[model samples]
Target: MFDVQHLSYQAGRKPLLRDVSLQARPGELLAIVGANGAGKSTLLRLLSGDVAPSDGLVQFDGQPLASIPAAMLARRRAVLTQQHTLSLAFRVQELVLMGRYPYFRGQPSAHDYAVVADALATVGLSALAERSYPTLSGGEQQRAQLARVLAQVWEAELGFLLLDEPLTGLDLNHQHHTLDVARALVQRGFGVVAVLHDLNLAAQYADQVLVLRQGAVVASGVPAAVLTAAHIEHAFDIAVELLPHPSLDCPLIVPRPRAGVGAAFSL
Candidate 1:
């Protein structure tokens, strides 16, 4: 599990994140929701040890994150960013196999191949194993990236996954499918801290929600506890109805127009 305490960061004279703190419980799905420039990505980078906090502490399983070695950290936590671009053209299978580099040091074994195969299967990419990554569709590319991250933490007893805008650039079906894969990963005892732009998607999949505005947490708790009509309205500057999802037993958000606005009555 990941625990952040009194986290704060600054970019030159400007503050990016201030007084941010939260804990991701083991096997729970925690979604971080905020508008642009709200420091969500900064938070993720700090947690993943890609960037150190200017002021505060990040702990992984009781030890400070900085205390963990880089190689060992990769074995414990996996991260997938929003902008995953591959400059070098590689086959889908090859890109995924790269995840085992920490263990195999560029020379894969039979066990590494087994792990990569399982990772591909987890993301439903086995059929496209031999496909070239650059020629694949955007959705397929995203799934390939998912497969890489899956292989990174594959059966390594990982504690958490740090994902930023993981549902970007996908159609509705793939969005749902990708989130389902994330959910299944969390169910298998991986804590997840995902920064998501889509509040409804967060509401549907996240066990807990953290709403940040202007680089601070406005609310943090279970989805129902944090995702209220007024909270959404305040955090997002839009009016929405928080309804009960018929099957998921979670809150669903339905956007409604503000007063004096109509579809046919435009100024």
Candidate 2:
């Protein structure tokens, strides 16, 4: 449902992303993983059309991202970035209700209210709907932001969902549950591309993985193919031991021994 071809992003003289090409399909969850400064966030921004690519095109359903009108794009695509801060003294329900802005001009209709309520309930925020946004903790706020996106783009069919580092600040249970929500969306035929810091979570949740190193795609494929121990060491410069999970039906990654602690190995 979403395609990026030869995508590149330049900031001044430095290129943040270089020739990053990939595709996201309906009923699939794609995770982009890389170390800090590897341009994961930049790639997400480019894919979401929040920032235009300095080179090539980001296409959604065969249409150039730049050609889409703002209102039309918002009605189809939804983005939840890492930086979410609001100083306004609005209630949580009121905040989540903002997601319906794309559907309603300014005033929300009954359908919009129903969407907002559903979004709040989806994120387990129904009880906190009347609370102030500022009073919630960081994790709660993050979930609230997701609820807003859910409410905003619920009417959107055949669209892209870009979530940049959505797991940050979330507890373990919330993190897993957040991915559960995303996976449910994919099951319902939404194309999802997320920037994930936790490789374990990515391996467990993503249908495919895209590994970025130094602004370029170093590897991209199924988790079992793209998340090998060598690739993890090469991309992140950290040694990890790859082994099958004891009970779970997936590969698990664990930190390898330190330099002086065990035998050395080459990548």
- Residues 15-50, candidate 1: write the lDDT tens digits: 999999899987899999987888899999999998
TM-score of every model versus the real structure: 0.94, 0.95
Give the per-residue lDDT digits (tens) of candidate 2, residues 88-193: 8899999998878878776788988999999999999999999999999999999999999988778678666789999878999999999999999988888789
- Model 1 residue runs over 4 Å out of place are 259-267
- Count clashing pairs, candidate 1: 0
Q: What is each predicted model's overall lDDT from 0 to 1?
A: 0.87, 0.89
lDDT of candidate 1 vs native?
A: 0.87
